[model samples]
Target: MITAIRRMFSSTIGKFLALAFVVLVGVAFALSDVTGNSTFGGIGGANVAKVGSEEIGLGELRDRVRLAYNQARQDQPTLTMAAFVESGGLDRVLDQLIEGMAFEQLATDMGLGVSKRLIDGRIADIPAFAGVSGSFDQTRFQSFLRENGLTEAQLRRDLRQQLLLEQLAGPIASMPRLATGMAQPYAALLLEQRRGQAAFIPASPFAPATDPGDAALQTHLSQNRGKFTIPERRVIQYALFDAASAPVPAVTDAEIARVYKDNASQFAASETRRFAQVIAPDQAAANALAAKVRGGTALAAAAQAAGLAPSMSGELTLSSYAATTSDAAAKTAFAAKRGDVIGPFQTGLGWVVARVEDITARPARSLADATPEIRAELAKNKANEAIVDYYNTIQDAVNSGASIEEIAADRKLALATTPPLLASGRAPGQPGYSLSPELAPLVSQAFQGAAEGEGQLATLVENEKFAIYAVKNIIAAAPPPFAQIRPDLLADWRLAQGQKIARDKARAIAKAVEGGQSLGAAVAAAGPNIGSVQTIGGRRGELGQDGQPVPPEVALLFSMAQNSVKTLEIPGNRGWLVIALADVQRPDPKSIEPARVAAIAQPLAPAFGNELVEQLAAEAKRRIGVTINKKLVDQLRQELTGNAPVAE
Candidate 1:
């Protein structure tokens, strides 16, 4: 229980909570309310709530809410306090705190508590409090507490409460017997086999009774305007400044010679060898194989006789071979001449007999042979420097309020403009607007900065490219005219009508089957194009002939009684299916393997424990009687968010 509690507080949630508390402290200091009496000065700064005789202070409540806000911002980066409130983030945080306090109160009533020494151990275990040598350092701990506006006493008190709650809930939640009964029924269902036949009635075979005219199209458009509405788009004018386009100084011969002299070792190659080996399970087997190879039997033939295939060790350096095989094997192979057969040597993987096929010696290259690569590297570096200098000049122009066009003209940079394109890179019904992958970042930046009405410099590729862009025009989202989408509307209307026809046919077939008619006979009576019924059998998770898990419709078949039939709409408007349950073959409970049952129960155990813990906490809350100060909570909410209280 202590380990679990420590892990929870040391994980991401703990880090986020600490950061949020520090942020709250900073905000309080900046607002001149560090003492808690200046901003929320009324009601003598009392506790926000009480669980039995225990009080949850206003400062702690505010910090928890802020922590929730910070955590939520990881998923929704633009989340505002108003949005957070609307999403019920504050209420959730309060409920969590209330539940925790309820557990702590229950623990106190039962005389369960954590010792000061345990609390000290838990604090010392936190890595953030550790020094360079990895043991808890008093100086670092004190410095952290001071910087985060937390006192040692307050931290210890919080840790003790957390530990006590864990002590109260841990045993009740860790009961192993709770999952056994719940897992049995699910395991039986998972292991049950079923056989059934389904026939599909294709929606494509049924056509609409009549075409959708203008009036019908207009009505459809009016009812589903959001579907036809286009997203807001922006037209951007931008310029890319990159190293590839910058002027580079030419590389001199003397400079290439100096670079080659300074980095001579880089141009030297290592000796390597190619070899093949036959591994045996024992020294006797390896010795027999080595004797056969020495007696002029081909290595492959000898390996084949030994019931093992010859394996090749592709060209490898001495160090590389030593890392993979044993140092003894590598040393023997390297010392042997080319085409030499050696090694009945012992290795980490039993024993090996090796034959060297070829060997290559290390060699050094002359300066002339290395000049081309050095000159290219020098040119790249010089071009990068030039680009950086040019960007600084561009930054100066931007600071002076020069327009993109003016900067491009003065600097001779390439400038281009894009047509109004949606953030999804689509114009209308057409596929995405084609743009180079390198320009994606610039496009994203343009959309983000469109509202500001000024050119913004954005990094395109880190250290290689940069772009400056401004919105030339803004196109607001609106629904297309009925005339413009008339064809698409007609096609959609036809598809919907065809689907209804298919559904009606499927429902009739299902009714007939439920009335004791054979599924194959009903499907044949429906039409010749409706494919013949086929039987598929499998356990719940087994894949069918199509290599997909037994379809949901088939799974539903097992849930029904024998001879019962149902109609299901297949996904993607392909068709509707009328399925009849044929047989459900359940395995005998005694015959079910213990390993399979355990596999099914392992993941469910933790979930069942969590549910029990939640129920216990709720019961504890009721027993202790939680009292929340609504007026004070509302005032604190307002002060923290700068928004008026939302009426309950």
Candidate 2:
């Protein structure tokens, strides 16, 4: 029960809900007046929803929807409140809140309640509320409540409800042990292997006798015009304010020295020691080995006598030692002098006995040695600040109606106009064109059907850089002229002809093999265009020789009776293949390794548990019954999105 409770509170959903509660509390206080008592017709009175007897008030729903809106904006900075609402963000938040209320109601019916002490302990355990002494501070807690606009009573109520929900739901979701019999069949299937013979008839080998004539080409182009139509393209003119191009301020000697002084520990190297260790299964064995080493016996001899392996460690710093061994062992090793025998301390690996062979004390690097790195860091910081200031000035000018080109020329910033190119940033049979990495967002904005003189400021590379671009021209998507695409049309026409020929040849070969001819003999009789027949040992869950999964046709070979030949169409114009099942290999039950089956089953336990929990939750919801006001929901959606309401 304790484990389940801990797991619940540590889960991703739990953490997100906790964070949302904290964030929404602050937002609710600030927006309380704006969201309070808002009604949607007569249906959306004070309550937006009712899960069991618990009512989700209009104010609470608004706060959750607002929080969801803010989170959406973080993922897509250009997303507006209307876009979020239209994307069903409000519905999703309401669903989560309703589910939470259902769980709370279930907990109440179960008589699951948390005491004041438990709530206090939970709050004290939160690291965010801890002081420098690593204990909960009353002042800090009260200050947090004030900042987030949460009263003590409100916070206690929320915490108590959350605990109750966790107590009720945790056990259902806890991982359960799966039996070996449940997983062995799957393991055997995954390990099953088969061998077969396959023949591939490729389309490229069977080319058409001649290219289609001009009239045929015209007909093909008309019939398949959509395939050749180009996507909309745009010609864009953009100006970039790059940090790399910004003037870097010179760093002074005093500045370098100050940095070196402030970060003195970083410049100092840690002391390291070479160690020889003997690991034993228990402390008694480890202690005996240590005593032998201290009494002048060699570590190797002691280990051999104790039936343990002796190993030598390279130069290990205190941090490395703690990582490789245990903190207790590392502390003992570091405090000892050269040739001192230490340990017999317990670690995750085993009980360890170690001897220090050599020690090296590291000295700090001089200021002269660290000057180059410090200078580069300082210069980069200055350049970043300069670029930010430069971008602000350019953005202000652009907003005030001064053209980007004029500002670029005056400020000597990089300004360029791209040739008309498709949305993919390329033109047919031409060198590919691409915007600068820092200005890539300009391409999307440019093709958003902006009018020829319209301009917009878009963030590029996040806060580091931005570009203001204007659409120089728009290229409507349409089929190119027949004469312009004649070569492509001819090639595609021939490929179609070739694919038909290959399919026909494959069918003939399949017929021959079905008539009792060997696969190799059938392919040989089909003319030289049909490629060589290859035999593959197809293993379930293993790739074929071609670095792909054994083709689906070949995989079906295992299910066929011995020597059965089946014809299946291969995808991607690779043509059809006839696979002859030569052998099937099933793993012997008695020879199956229990350890391997257990390894495969380990990851499946949590999935089975989660499935059970979903079923249980669904049943619980059904038993409790849930009623939603469709009119209120529709009205809320219309209000948030400014869409016309649907007639009932």
Cα lDDT of all candidates, in order? 0.69, 0.68
Segments of candidate 1 deviating more than 4 angstroms: 1-190, 203-206, 225-234, 247-379, 388-403, 422-466, 471-479, 520-537, 543-552, 555-564, 570-575, 588-590, 594-648
Can you write out model 2's per-residue Cα lDDT over 1-648, one digit (the tens) per residue?
A: 012212222343442234324433322221222223544444333676677766666656665575455444333434445656766777766765566666666777888888999988877876545532346857556654553445777666667767876686667656667788887876787688888898877777776768769999999877665457664566788876667656667889999999999999889976989998887998888878888988999999999987888888998889899998778778889999999999888888899898899999978788998899999999877776777666656655755667777877877778788887655456554575554555555665454333476545566665566676788887655678888999988877776667778878778876787788888998998888677888876567455645855657666676787777777766544567767877878796546799988886786676666666556556556766677767666767776654555334
Worst lDDT run of 10 residues, candidate 1, spans: 25-34
User: Least lDDT summed over 10 consecutive residues: which range in candidate 2?
Assistant: 1-10
- Could you say which candidate leads in lDDT? 1
Question: What C-alpha lDDT does candidate 1 achieve relative to the native structure?
Answer: 0.69
